[model samples]
Target chain A: MEAFLKYFDLLELSQEAGIEDVRKNYDYLKNLYSGDSIEIAALNTDFSPELRQEYLARLDDAHEKLTQLLENKKPAVAQNTVRMDDELCDWIANIACFSGAALKSIRERMVVDLKDMFTTTRIQLQYLEDIENEVFESFRAEVYLRSYLVEYTRFLSLDTPRVLADYLPRYRAWAASRTTPAGMPHL
Target chain B: MIWAIGGGKGGTGKSFITSSMGTYLAQKGRKTILLDADLGGANLHTFFGLTRPRYSLTDFFDKKVALQDISVQSGIANLDLITGSIGSLDSESINHGQKQKLFRHIRALDADHIIIDLGAGTHINTLDTFLLADRMIVVTAPEVTALENMYHFIKSAYFRKLKFIFKAYDLTTSIQETWKNRATYDIHNLKDLIIHLKQSSDRVRDIFDREMSGFVVHIVLNQVRTPRDILVGENLKSVCMNFLGLPVVYAGYARFDEAVLKNINSKEPFMLSNRLSPVATEIKALAENIIAGTHISVRKDVANGSLS
Candidate 1:
C-alpha cells in the first residue's frame, strides 16, 4: 500500500474504487471548493481563503493520483498453471531481445538503456517485464496488453504491429490451452 | 436516480434526447426505465420503433396494473420502458390525486434510474414531475425560443420548489401574498422574494435555505450542428447561475447527426447505431459526464449571507 492510497479513504472510497467513483467524488469536491457560487458559499461559511485553497489543491492532487492509478492499473488476469508452447515461447524470446537491440553482452547495461528509453516514452517497467518474460502469464486482458505492446515497441523504435500480430496468437493459444484436459495441442 | 427531461418549447428534441440518453445509460449496465410522462403527446414510443406499447401507463391507471407490470423490454440491454399513451384520461390533465398516485408509483420503482420524458410546456403535472426528479436534465436546442423556454421552465420550477417547501408550514398565506405581490409588481426573480422571506420568520428562511441548496438544475443541449451550438450549454449555465440564482451543471451536448434522424425514423437507438459516429461519441461522453458528475461550468459558492 503506497502512502497515496489514503487519498481513497479521504474521498470516502475503498482501494478498489471504480472510475465512476473517482469522477463523482472529484466533481463534488471541485464544486465544493471552486468558490464561484453563492449557494455553496451559503453552505460552507467558515473556511478561510487560504484554508480553502490548500484543501482544494490537496483534493486535486488526490483526484489526479487516483485517476493515474485507474489508467495504469493492471487487470487481475489468471496466471497460475497457464503454459505456452515451446516453439511460440522461443519465438517470443527472440522478440524479447527487440530484434537484437537488447542482445548486448552487458545485461545490466541493457536494463539501464531500456529504462531511459521507457522513461522518455512513459512506458512502465512492469510492461517491459510482461514482454520479456514469455513464460509468465499476463496480469491484464489481451487487448490492453497488445496496446501497451504497441507503445512499448514504438518506444524501442519497433513502431509497428508485427510483434502484436505474432505474439497474440500464441498468447490466445496459451490462454485456450489452460482450459483443456491435458492442456490441448499446440497452436 | 430519477431524471426528468423537459424543455419549455416544443421540437427542441426532448424525446430524442431522452431515448438516446436512456439508451446510453442502459448500455452502461444501468437498470434504466424511460417513462413517457408526455401525456398529451405520447410519442416516446415512436422513437423506439414501436407504433404503440403493448402495455402503456393506461393499463396502470384504468386496469389497475402494477407499475412494474406495465414496463416492457426496450430491446436495449438493462433498459425497461414505460410507454405513455393518449387515452381518455390524459397525462397533461391528471388530477392532483392521480399525480400523487403516479409519484408514489414512480418512487416505488426498483430500477437504478427512472427517466421521465416530460411533455412540453410547464403544466402543473410537468412541473411537479420535473421537480421530483433526483436529477433533472433540461433539453434545449441552439435557438432563441428554445433557450427562452428553458429559462421559463427553470423559473417555474424555482417557484414550484418554493411552493412545495412552504406548503409544509402555515406560511402559505404569507408566501402566496408575497408571490402575488411579485406577480402584480412584475418582480419575477426569486432574489428579491428570498430577501423578503429572510426578513420574515427564521423557519421560512431555514426552509428556503435547505430547498435552494438541494435544488440543482442540469442542462443538456441537443441538435448541435457546430462549435457555436456546443457552446450554448456553457453560455446557458452562466445565464442561469447569474439570473436564476440556481446552480446549474452544463452536462455537455449532442450533435445533429443525420444518422440520429435516420435512427429515430428506423427506431434504432444512437448507441446501437454507428457508435463511432460523432453524435454517438458525444452521447457516450454525455453518459460519462452524467455518471461522473463532472464538467460543471458553474462552481458552487460556500459564502454565507448576512442572514445565515
Candidate 2:
C-alpha cells in the first residue's frame, strides 16, 4: 500500500498542504497500516495484549505526526526519530492499517444510517398522503350532501296551489301575527 | 390468480364468458370475484339483472368504501359482483391514473378466483389492464373478422409483455432497436424473434418460456353456428403454434344457441335462466376445465413458495 502511495507524488505529506490534502495523506497512511495489521493478525492469532497495545500506540503516534504536520507545518521530533528501528516502523505501519479498518466500519455505519433515515421518511410521507386523501374524500361528500339538503329545503318550502291551499292553523297564526294582509280572507 | 378478459373488438362475448364462468364457479362452491374492470362501457350489472348497483367500482375508486365492502353477492351464492360505473362513467372520465387505482383495488380483492371483464380494444388502458392478469383468455368467435382481430390482439400483447420484461433487465433500448425496426415486425414467426432475443438475454427467454409453458393460450369459441364451428378452435390452436409456437388450449366452445340470445335480450344471465341449454352446458364444461387447469398451476405455485 505504501509502495502504491510512493508512485503518486500528490499523496506525499507536505508543510503548506490544506486540510483536504492532510486528510488524503492520513487516509493513505491508515490504509497501509490496516493492511499490515490484517496480515499480522491473520498469521499471529495468539498475539499478546502487550504486542497489540504496542502496535496501537505506534498507529496513534503516526496519526499524531500527520496532525502535527497539518497544525504546525513541521514533522514530529526529528532528533528522537528511531530511523534504524525496523520493529518500531513495522508497529507504526500496523497502526495505520488498523485506522483504515476503523474508517471502513465508520463508512458502512453511515450508509446503513442514511438508508434507515430515507425509509423512515418515505413511510411518514405515505402515511401523510393517506390521511390527506381521506380528508379530501370527506370534504367532497360533505359538499354534495350540503347541496342536496339545500335543494330539498327549497322543494319543501314551495307554496301550494290555491285549490289545495297552503292555509292551515300555522298559516292563520302567521297572518294574524302580520301587521297587514292584502288578500281576501277565505272561510 | 385473476384473469382479465379483454380484446380490441366489442360484442365479442367478453361479458358473456366472464359471467358464465363466474356463475359456474359459484355453483361449484369456489368463491369468485367477478370484477367489472370496464370503466368506459360497463354493462355486467345489466347482464345479471341489476337495474341499479348499490355499490360499484366507482365507490372503490372514489374511496367511499374498500374494494371488499363494495362487492355485491351474486344470487348465484359464491360469486360476488363489483360493477363498474353504472350511470356516470364516461370514456374520458376514467384516466390512466384512475385505471391504475382500479387495478390495485382488483388485486386486493379477496376471493379464490378473480375474473375481470375488461372493455374491448387495444386502447393503451385496455391493454395494460389485460396484461395485468395472472392468465389471459382471448375470447373470439369462429368468424373471419374475429380471428383476424384476435391475431393482432395477441401480437400486441406479446410485444408489450416482451417490452416490459426487456425494460426490467435494462435492455429496452437494444430490444427496441432490434425488434421495433420495420424488418423485425414483418417476420411471420414470433418464435424466431424470441430465439434471437434469447441470444441477447436469459431473462427475456425465461419470460417467453414461462408464458408459453404455464398457460395454453385458452380459447373460447362463442356463437358456433354449425358442426364446422367446432373446427375453428382447432384451427386457432394451429395458428397460435405456427405463428407464436405456443401450446394453445381449446378450452371449449359455446355454440350459437337461441337460448343465449333470448337471455341476452331479456337482460338475464343464461346460466341463471337455462342451465340445461347447450351453450350453458358448454360453458359449465369449459369452467371445469379452467378450474382443473388452474389447480395444477396453483400446485406448482405452492411448490415455488406462492401460497394463498
Candidate 3:
C-alpha cells in the first residue's frame, strides 16, 4: 500500500479523495473499458484489447489499495481535529527535551523505536525535529505533511487523523502570517 | 468433460457464465459443446447471440433427429451448441427413463468439453442432470437472496448425490425413510445425515464414504461490486465445507459491468465483444481453473471430468 500510493497520480485520483470518491472513480474507469464501452469507441479507434484489459486491471489494483489514506478520507472539520491539549504537545516537546525516562528521553530514541515498530515507515531526522517542535513551516506540501503527521502522531499514540486535523488549521494560520494580504508568493 | 452450470436462484447469470466459458474453452483449441439443459426456460444460445438455429434438441426429440444432427455450429471455431427446446412441455414433462436416455446421449457427445446450462430452480430434472455432470458449477450474484438460494441448491445437489449413493444398499428404501423421519431422531442438515449414516451398518457407511469423497462442486460469484463481495465465493465455500462436508471450488468472480446489459441488448457475445473487460478476464481464469481441476483446494483427485 505504501508503495502503491505513488499510483495516485497514475490513477488520476487526488491523494485526498474520500472512499466514496475512490469507489466512484473505480467504477467509472471500469465501465469505460467494458465490452460495449462507448468511451473506447469514441476515444481510441485503434485500441488494443490486451492493453485495455491490462490498464483496467491496473486501475482495479490501484483502487483496491486502502493504505492510511482511507483513514484520512473524511477531511476533518475544525472541531474534529485531534486535540493535543497544550499538555500533550508540551509533553512531546518535554519528552524529547527533558524526560528522565530512558525510552522517552530523546526525540532520536523515540524515532528509532517508532521506526522499529513501523518497519516500512520512512522518516528523516529533520521531519522528526519539526514534528517535535510543532514548527509546521518546512513541510508545507499539505498532503505529504498531513500524511506524515498522521503517522507520527499515531506512533506517539495520539488521536491519529483527528490530531493531524486539528494541527492543519494552525499550520495554515502560521503560513498565512508569512504571506501578504494580496496572496503574493513568499518564503 | 461435461460441466453442468446450475444455481437454484433465477437471474444469477448461469447462462452468461456457461456461454462465456464455452467460448473460452473453444478459443483455447478445445472441442467444446454447450447444451441448454433448461427444459422449460432454456436460453443459453442467446448469449452467443444465437436466437434460432436450423436444428435444436426439440428436433432431436420430435423429428427423430440424431443428437449429432442437432449439434449446431456456434460460429466460434471448435465450438458447437445444441440449441435448447423453446418452451416445449414435452421436454419439461420427460419421464425419468426418457430423461436418463437423453442424458446418456448427451454424455456420448463427441467433444472434449460439454457445458450444459441448467435452468433456475431445484427441480429433479435440474438436480439429476447437474449431479450427472463430470463437473458442476453453482453461480450466484453477490446478494443475500442469491447466496441463500445457492445454499439451498448445494443442499439439494448433495441430497441427490446421497440418494444415488444410498441406492446401492439392499436396505436403501428403509434407510431413506428412517433417515428422513426426523421424529424418530432429530437429523438436521447434511451433517446430521452423515452422522445418521455413521450409525448404520459398516457397509452402508463405507459406500457413502467412498462416493462422497469423489463428489466435488464448484462455485462462481458474479456481478460483484465491493471488494468485500469478492470473498463471497470463498465464504460460501467455507460454509458448505463446515456444514455439509462438500468440496467447493471458488473459481473466481466477475465484477459488475454495465456493458453486460448492453451486450445482451445488442446480441453480442461478451467475451468476444468485450475482450479486455474484467468480467472477460475473470471468466477466462475460471475456465482455466476448471480445466486444471484445481477448484478443489484440497488434494482430491480431479474427477477425470466425470461426476458419474
- What are the DockQ scores of the candidates, in order? 0.01, 0.00, 0.01
lDDT, model 3: 0.69
In terms of docking quality, model 1 is incorrect
Candidate 1 C-alpha lDDT tens digits along B205-255: 676776677687777888877554555566555445544567788887877
What TM-score does candidate 2 get on C-alpha atoms?
Answer: 0.55
**Per-residue lDDT tens digits of candidate 2, residues B1-308?**
88878755778798999998898887888889898877787988777888788998777767658888998877778888998885567545678887777778778878989998877777666777777887677788766567667666776776776667667668778765776663845532456566677655666666656654554556777777755456556545534653355566777777777777778789887888786777777888777666565311111011122111
Which segments of model 2 are wrong by more than 4 Å? A1-187, B90-97, B180-190, B200-216, B294-308
- Report each candidate's C-alpha RMSD, comma-separated, in the order given: 18.2, 32.3, 19.9
Candidate 3 segments whose C-alpha is farther than 4 A from its true place: A1-187, B173-186, B295-308
Candidate 1 segments whose C-alpha is farther than 4 A from its true place = A1-187, B87-89, B176-188, B199-201, B296-308
Residue-wise C-alpha lDDT for candidate 3, range B125-186, written one tens digit per residue: 88999988888888888776776677778878888877776676665777768767965777
RMSD value for candidate 2: 32.3
Q: Rank the candidates by TM-score, best first.
A: 3, 1, 2
| Residue A134 in candidate 2, Cα distance off native in Å | 77
Using Cα atoms with residue i matched to residue i, what is each candidate's TM-score against the true structure?
Answer: 0.58, 0.55, 0.58
The native-contact fraction of candidate 3 is 0.00
Q: On residues A100-121, what C-alpha lDDT tens digit does candidate 1 reach at each position?
A: 2232222233233556535554
Model 2 chain A poorest 10 in a row by lDDT: A155-164
